[model samples]
Each structure stands twice: as C-alpha cells, then as structure tokens.
Target: METNSKETLQADFDVFDISEEFGFLLEEPLTHLPDHYQVWLDLANNLIHLIESRKLRDLVDKMPVLSPDLLSDHRELRLAHLALGFISMGYVWQEGQHAPAEILPKALALPFWLVSRRLGLPPILTYADSVLANWKLKDPTGDMRIGNMDLIFSFPGGDTCRGFFIVSLLVEMAASPGIMGALEVMRAIKVSDLTGIKNGLIKVTQSLKKMKEKFKFMHNHVEPAAFHGKLRIFVSGWRDNPMLPRGVMYEGVSDEPILLSGGSAAQSSAIQCFDALLCIQHEEETGAFLTRMRDYMPPAHRQLIETLSVCPPLRDFILSCSNSDLCQAYNSCVSALVDLRNYHLNTVTKYVIIPGNHAQSVGCPFRGVGTALNTTGTGGSNLMVFLKSVRNTTQKALILERLS
Candidate 1:
C-alpha cells in the first residue's frame, strides 16, 4: 500500500472521539454544560415554552454575550454548540416564518459564532448539532434505540418534533457499522483481497438495510401536519429561504449578511461516505449540492468522506477481478443504497410534497413557511428534481455487464 492509503486505512474508519459505536454520533453526549453556562441550558430547556409564550426574543435580547473561551472540553464545546444552535434557531423563527427575525442579537450570535469556530462547524443548526450530538439514553445502560432515546434540545412540535430529531439520530446510529464496513473495504482493496472486499460490502449492505428500517419509524412518530407546520421552520436556514431573502445578520460577527442552509439530512456524512466508497457518480447539479452540504457537516466526518473519495478504486477492482460473486456483493451494496434513497423519495412525498399541496389548496395562513414547501427543501434545493436526480445517479452505479 502507498504511505497515504495505509495512513487513511488507519485514520478514516474511526475519527477519535468523533466516531463511536454510533458512527459519527458522540458515544455519550453531554446533556448539560457546567454551571457557568446554565443560562444557555435554561434558555434551551425552556425554549418551546419561551417560543410559545412569545418571550424567547425578550429573554435572548437581555441575556449576556458569554465567551466560547470559557468552554475548553470537546464534549462541552459540542454541548454549547447544540444548545446555542437550538436557541438561535428558535430565536430566529420565534414569530414563525411569516414574520421571521432578520438579525440575531449579539448576545446570541457572538458566542454561537465563536463556538462554531472552535468546533469547525458553521454558525447554524445542522445535522451535526441536531441529530449527531443531540441525544441521550433514557436509561443510562440502555441500547441506543429510538425507544430508549430522547433529545437534549428540541423545537416546538411536541412529540413529533422529538420524534423527528431522535429518528434522524437512530438512522445515523444504524449507519455506524456500515461506516466501519466501508473502511474495511478500503483496507481490503489496498491489499487486493477480493474475499475481504466482498465481506466488507456485505456489511455495508446490511447497514444500509438497517438505515432504511430505522427511517420507517419516521411515519410512526411524526405526523406530516405537525412536521410541516410546526417543526420545519426551526430547522430552515437563511439561504434561499423566501422568509430571509436578505439572509441573517449575525450582529457582531459580520457587517454583511451571512447565508446558510438549514439542518438538512444532506448534511449527514453517512450517505455521502457510502457514495464516496461506491464511487457513485451524480450529475453536475445534484453533485454540486451534495458537495455544498458537506460544508455543514462536522469537519472530521467531512474529512472522512474526503479520504474515502481518494482511496483505492473499489469499483474498478471489482470489474477487473471478473468474479461474479464479487460483482454481486458490490452491486448489492449499491442496490441497498438505491433502495434507501427510493424510500427517502417516498417519505419526502408524504412529509413535504403532500402536505405542501394540501396547504396550497386550502390557502394556508402561514405563507412564509409554506412558500418553499413543495418547491424547495429545507436545504433550499428544488425538492422532487434534486432527489430524483440523486436516486437516478445512484442507480447508474450498478455494474450491469458484471452482473451478467
């Protein structure tokens, strides 16, 4: 193996502290910061209440602009980011999308920007903050299943809001083994071990299947009405959002407005990691958007995907080997990913497009929230077109000749 590939094999699978048994999820997220930062925890814990009572803005406006320098531990910084991300999202969308706040006060924006700098994440709520580092086990010794989990911070959609974030967390957890499997495939490819490669691909396929199963729990816990009307805005970002056309001013951070995408599943690293490993090619537009979403991911997870993209070519090796079983295993991994994407398409149709059409037909009152509903995603892409294009590109990754 080349020096770089050997190093990649050792480093990419488990990003120390970043990758735990739950893949990108922190092993045990800190539910509270130290007493000094209790102001943030107090605001975050009572966020739904504050937003509902129309007092979140008043409280945030009066709170002190604490320094991120006070937080030194990695886990503490992550907790700070999580709490701040939730509070900021709530603050911006407190009046709902129609009358959204345009400028985040210095008290909230400064600490969040600094915490984001310390963590190498953007100054907004992301899948990293909301899903990856946001959950805790109800019972300390319990498995990380949805039933055993609850969110550390949440939006105002009641159980549906809790369900949305936790289910997303479980999906990431389900992908943990596959992440390890992809690394194994990389190692096996470095050694030209065909049997090893085949086994690794099998693990990846199994993990994708588990991810799809976990995704189904979305329906059981989240109602489309509550998700679209109540929970969606809190996760919506500044860029491409009709509500925040000028984007948000981060008070003391920048003179010009800063634009960012919302807390998106596209920001999750697991699927993108699989895409890198399988060498699945997307069209220019779809691929560009996926690439952009990487900016919203935790830096370490983003680095893992970057490493996987440059690793030894697994798809080419599978073709050169001319082994039907090997081809079958590789194709199974691709097929499983394709199946997961298809299920995602169906879920979006139910959760986003369907509710959007209903809202439009009935002349919904919350125009700002409903503006991008069927047309655009929380990440600001053309909803159906982007997803379909991605799914199609993943389908093209199937090695047809090798199958025969």
Candidate 2:
C-alpha cells in the first residue's frame, strides 16, 4: 500500500510537459535548460525518497551531477546543473536524517569554490569561478543567482529569500563534521527563546565569519562593484490613505532618486537636488490632480501620467493592504508585490519595503474591526489573508519570470 501510494503521488506530480516554445527558450545554447530539467526532476524525486529511507549511499551517488570534473567540461551548462543540485541538496538537508559522518564534510567542501567566485575571487579558485560566471550571465539586473553547486538559488527580495538561503546553507553545513558540531549547538537552543535565539544567531554569524576568512586569501583579485550609482525608487500611493508612513526613507543611501505621488498640490517641487518624488495620490484626490494636470500639461505629458496611473496590481495591492489579518499578513504582502510586478507597475526598477511589524506576523490585531468587516474564522484577519494571497502571487511571478 505504501509503495502504491508513493507511486501514485509521483505519477500525479512528475509527468511534466514541456511545450515547443518553452523547450526552444530553455534549451537554447546559452541556457541548455531542457538538457538538465528532466535529469533534475528525476534526481530531485530520488533524493526525496532517499531522505525518507535514510539511504546515504543513494544520495551520495546522486552528487556526481555537481562533480567538478563533469561540470568543468560543460561550463555554460553550469547554472542549470547547479540549480538542480542545490535544490535537491537543500531538500535532503532540510528533511533527511542528521548523519554528519556520512555527508557533512562533502557538503561543506562543495560551495567553497562557488561562494569564492561569487565574491569575485581568482580564476584558479575551484568550482566557484564557473558558478559565479553562470549567474552573472543569467539575469544581472534580477535577483536570482545560484549560491552553490548543490543547486541552491538565492533571490534578493526579502526575509523569505534570506530564510531559504539560510536553510540551504545550513543543510550544507550540517553535512560537514565541524559545521555539524556548530549546528548541534544551535539545535540545543530554542529559537523561540529570546536569549537562546540571540546566542544561536551569534554562533551562526561567527561560523560564517570563519568561513569568509578561510576563503579570503583566494580573493586578491576584485571585480567591479555589482551595484553602482544612485538607485531610482518610484512610490505609488492611494489618495486617501498612503501605506508609506511620513518619516519613511529608503534604507540604503541618501542620493537615490525617489518618485512620489502629488495628489492635491498644484506646484511641482523643484527636482534639482531631490532624490525622490511623491506622485499625486490616485484614489480620492485623483479628480483634482487630473483636472490640474489636464489644464497645465501638454498632451504627451498627460498621456504618460495616464499610463503610469492605471496599474491594476497596485490597485489590488492597496485593497489587500486595507484588508489584512495576522494569519495572512506576510502572504498578502507577497501577493501585493507580485501583483504590482506582474502588472508591470514599475518594470524598469526594483523596489523593496520594510514591512511594518503589524504585517510581519500571522495574526490580525484588529479582531473586533476585522470581524465587523466580515472576516471570520481564518478569514477574520483581512491582513493575514492578504499577505498569504500576496505570497502566492509572488511565487507565481517568480516562477513565471524564470520560465519567461
């Protein structure tokens, strides 16, 4: 019965179909995705079963996909191969048995070369050189990059992406005898405990620092800075209730360009030294702004503003924010961002917001008001529901962007 059930589950999810266009796009010489996709899926499934069965030998056998010798021959195919390996390795580390004696050392050694190259180290550096080269070419403007040959990918969006990387890295570390000792120390502390969490984080930080130092000697050569100059940030606001608070500023530097909505004011602020502009609000004050701009602006300018104003995703995001709960706050935020991105609100720019504490957790603080607003049971928290919705949307957007 168990075998039958496993077979049924695999059959249901494993029969993936690749369209001709998708095949062409993914299998193109630069990407060669099709060549690795099926192999990855098979390996991923096998790894899942191996973890369940605690079959270390089987998992070890699967590691050859990321073997330096094999990967060195197909340098251009590194990303596709690495992505698969990292994903599979992460799965094993997260779910498999704690057997450092068998696999920890291998995992620790795997990414040394990869991470070094990503930091822009020497060409003679092991597998790291190829790993960085692959991601540097994949989508430089985007946040997706393979972290290690174990097939782990990192997205630079928010905590969720950070969490994913941490988990994957932890898994790799857990495979190392010394790193496993550090993890054992971590495992003893309760992450929910305030003091324990702090201590645990300190230990993890120290381990990372040590790892960095160990690889420092290999990185005398420096690459050009990946991010240079001022970044442009566009802020879209609702007329009546803008989500961004009054004192909020971009987190990084002072010189970044900020675009704000000017809903009611007729006078345009001087753009000379201003890094950001608040565009006029689109909701309640839309009428006044429209009238003023119509009277004062040329036809071309009006057309441009009109195009900027009609963002369906932004509108949906505002609605979700207005109705969020604890259970779904994170998800709602994810959904809102995804919606905005998918609708192409600010396609040319990348944006990140420090989600307030209210939207950070899983419950709605406004129980009475939420209930009054027709939120009941799990749905009682509008914010929570919205967050969940947003997360799903973001996941879809990421996958779509990858496929596209």
Instruction: Please report how far candidate 1 places residue 345 from its true position, in Å.
Output: 0.4
lDDT by residue for model 2 (1-404), tens: 67974564344222211111211011222333344244443443354344445563444445433333333433333443444433323332332112112122232224323422342321111122112222222444443223322223431123333332233223222212322222222223323223432343243334334333322321221111110000000011111112222311221222332222211112111100000101222222323433343322222223323433442333233233342321132233234334432332221111111112222243423211111122211111132333344334344422111110
Clashes by residue pair, model 1: none
> Candidate 1, which ten residues in sequence have the lowest lDDT sum?
11-20
User: For residues 23-111, could you state the per-residue lDDT of candidate 1 as single tens digits?
Assistant: 88876889877788899999999999999898999999999988878787989999999999999998999988678888999999999
Q: lDDT, candidate 1, residue 270?
A: 91
The TM-score between candidate 1 and the true structure equals 0.95
Q: After superposition, which runs of candidate 1 have C-alpha atoms over 4 Å from their true positions?
A: 1-20, 365-368, 402-404
Q: Given candidate 2, what's the lDDT at residue 141?
A: 49
- Tell me the deviation in Å of residue 327 in model 2: 37
- Whole-model Cα lDDT per candidate? 0.87, 0.27
TM-score of each: 0.95, 0.22
